[model samples]
Target: MSKTPKYFIVEAGALPEIFLKVAEAKRMLETGEVDTVHLATKRAGISRSAFYKYKDAVRPFNDMLQGRIVTFQILLKDEPGVLSSVLNIFARSGGNILTINQAIPANGCAAVTIGAETSGLEVSMEELLSRALSVEGVVRCEILAG
Candidate 1:
């Protein structure tokens, strides 16, 4: 039977140059900087055989969080344009809204749950929430689940 795969978070300086080159080639492919693996490997200064050998094994740390969908729950005052303002914060920061659900207004407040693909967020989650809370009529904001 094959052994289970184990992962390690090693520093870049300690890894071999080949591993780094493989990762760089992957990045170039992902970012559309190179149209083909041949070009990517050429630009990364590694042979195609070397890249193919280790391509599946190397990746950048931030890549692990790239496709994550975060759910945010915000409490806002029930007023015209209040919800739009909160959404504007996400729009400005490159957070893509996948889903939004709002409970009926009660006691002059509304509860909103927003699911956003935050991979492209220009600001950290905490900073995004802080900006949301700063908007007028927003009462409470927190990450419910991601």
Candidate 2:
């Protein structure tokens, strides 16, 4: 049986530069910045072989989750100011909050569901999630829907 592929959220700084180049080339092609993969790779400063090697494996987070209503399920520690700190992450990242529903604290944790419009995000979805996960009270944060 074929195992499902695993996914990871890696910081751009931690990734090889070639991956960024491939993403840039893909974006250039999609946006009409370049007419072909050859030109895209050339402009992005990566070899065509390098682009082809990683193209299918890398997609920009902004492209994957941009311009849509994204719903996030966040698990937070039941503590004062935890929710506010999480919401501030969204605000600072340009996520426009559309709705939020919080379940009562249970087992010293709270589950919060947030729906936000992501068209205006100043950072990538990956960056936004990383920031959320970095918060002191955030136990988990993930996209529930989009």
Candidate 3:
């Protein structure tokens, strides 16, 4: 059986410089700033082999998730200020909240679905999710779609 692919959210400072260079090279090519991978790699100050090695695996967070609308489903303890705290987290993270649909509290919990535009977010989606999860009374949080 084939194993599922695993991914990690790492800070930019922790990654090798070559990965950033490869992402830049790919962007240059996509935006027509460079005509070929050869020139793009040279301009990015990386070797062709290095660029090829990481091109598929390394991507800027903005390139992957920015300008997209994402929906998050959250399970929260039904208590005063719980939803407010979650919304505050999203706002502080730079996500633009578009809409929210919350269900009535039942069995001491409530389900809420939030839609947000991510273009202006200062942090990666993973970080945003982590922050949301860290909020008090948040039982669970997940990206339903994007």
Provide the TM-score for each candidate, comma-separated. 0.56, 0.70, 0.65
Q: Give candidates' CA RMSD values in order.
A: 7.2, 4.8, 6.1
Candidate 3 Cα outliers beyond 4 Å, as residue runs: 1-47, 53-62
Please report, in order, the local distance difference test score of every candidate based on alpha carbons: 0.89, 0.92, 0.91
Clashing residue pairs in candidate 3 are none
Q: Candidate 1, which ten residues in sequence have the lowest lDDT sum? A: 58-67
Clashes of 2: 0
Q: Judging by TM-score, tell me the better candidate of 1 and 2.
A: 2
**Which regions of candidate 2 are displaced past 4 Å?**
1-22, 28-37, 43-61
lDDT of the structure predicted as candidate 1? 0.89
**TM-score: model 3 vs. ground truth:** 0.65
Writing each residue's lDDT as its tens digit, candidate 2 over 1-146 gives 99887777687788999999998899899989889999999999999999989999997666767999999999999999999999999999999999999999999999999999999999888899999999999999999987
Clashes of each: 0, 0, 0
Winner on lDDT between 2 and 3 is 2
